[model samples]
Target: MNEAISLEAVSKVYGKGRGAVAALREVSVGLPEGGFTAIMGPSGSGKSTFLHCAAGLDRPSSGRVRLGGTDLAELSETKLTELRRERAGFVFQAFNLVSSLTVAQNITLPLRLAGKRADARRLAAIVERVGLTERTGHRPGQLSGGQQQRVAIARALIADPEVIFADEPTGALDTMTAREVLGLLRETVDALGQTIVMVTHDPVAASYADAVLFLADGRVVDTMTGPTAAGVADRMIRLGAWAK
Candidate 1:
């Protein structure tokens, strides 16, 4: 299977000398193409740090991070930025859409930033796929939380990115809205064959993934395939016990 992202013994440290904190330690994992993988752990488990490093938003202090087989450490800063913009997509819990831009405009923003024009057909299809065809003229303020997230998802897809990194995507939404958004993400993996690495604290949200990776104290301690919410919850409880 093709690897959408690979990390080989990656580690991230913040600060210096005795005060330095290890956010991640000797972490290595690969996200296979066309898979939906969720990262979950208790607070301070380096879930966010892992996502940032894997997505090229943060550089590892040691080891290698490769996005679609390209080693990020080898690239210049400009090239790394370009690679992330063109090859990677990001979704955050905040649904970071421009308030003034219409839905259509927001969705196309990434392509514009990349100095590329959108294909009219593909753009329309993306809008339709995300169930926002009629709301293209509406601004983010006019949309519901779920609708806003759908816009974010469409924006991520505008570039046809090889990998998508979502950081607690449904964290801010209501239970119903979160479920809808998670369903859309799951569908993207099944229907569009998109590879997604989502970091979430919610067991229900993690259950939407094809597999779930568990982190504890800056290390990956376990992984579960075809995880159910109950199963993930049980594992999380065990991790909590270990922490205590």
Candidate 2:
């Protein structure tokens, strides 16, 4: 399978000299096209730093991050911004929706930002797929937490991006709501062949992923495939002890 995202000896450091901190240490990994990966680690384990560097939200101090075989280090700031806007999708824990816009507008925000219009059929299908058809005219304030997350997922999918990056997507929802949102994400990968890389801490949440990459002190220490919730919890227990 083609590599959707690849990190080659990537390292990220902040500050300088004795004050400098290395958040990622020559980390290297490849995410296959259409694969779903969950990144997990204990507090201060560099999980967030890894995601930020990998997604181009922050640059690596050294090495390379490639998306679709193009090195991010080689792109100009303008080109990188354009690439992210056109080629990637993001779902955040906060939902990041514009309070002034309706659901439909929010879902199509990316297309509009590019000075393009949404494709009617595709937009309709996405709305229906995410179960947001009846809520299109509603504002975020009027919706429940679960409904709002569904809108966020729809917005992520409307762009038809090569990959989706989710940061604690279910962190704000109730258990039932979280389950529904996770199910939708899984369906997106299994049915639509979408690639997703998520940063999460919940064992149940990680269980939904095809594989989990466990990080510690800015390095990948272990990987678990075909994960189950109980198995993930057991592994995380070991990681917590290592964090000491």
Give the clashing pairs for model 1.
Answer: none
Residue 147 alpha-carbon offset, candidate 1, angstroms? 0.6
State the lDDT of candidate 1 residue by residue for 143-221, as single tens digits. 9999999999999999999998999999899999999999999999999999999999999999999999999988999
TM-score, cand. 2 vs. native: 0.99
Give, for candidate 1, the lowest lDDT window spanning 10 residues.
235-244
Residue 176, candidate 2: C-alpha displacement in angstroms: 0.4
TM-score of 1: 0.99
- The residue-by-residue lDDT of candidate 2 on 1-244, one tens digit each, is 8999999999999999999999999999999999999999998789999888778888999999999978999999889888888889989999999999999999999999988999999999999999988989999999999998888889888889999999999999999999999999999999999999999999999999999999999999999999999999999999999888
Model 2 regions more than 4 Å off = none
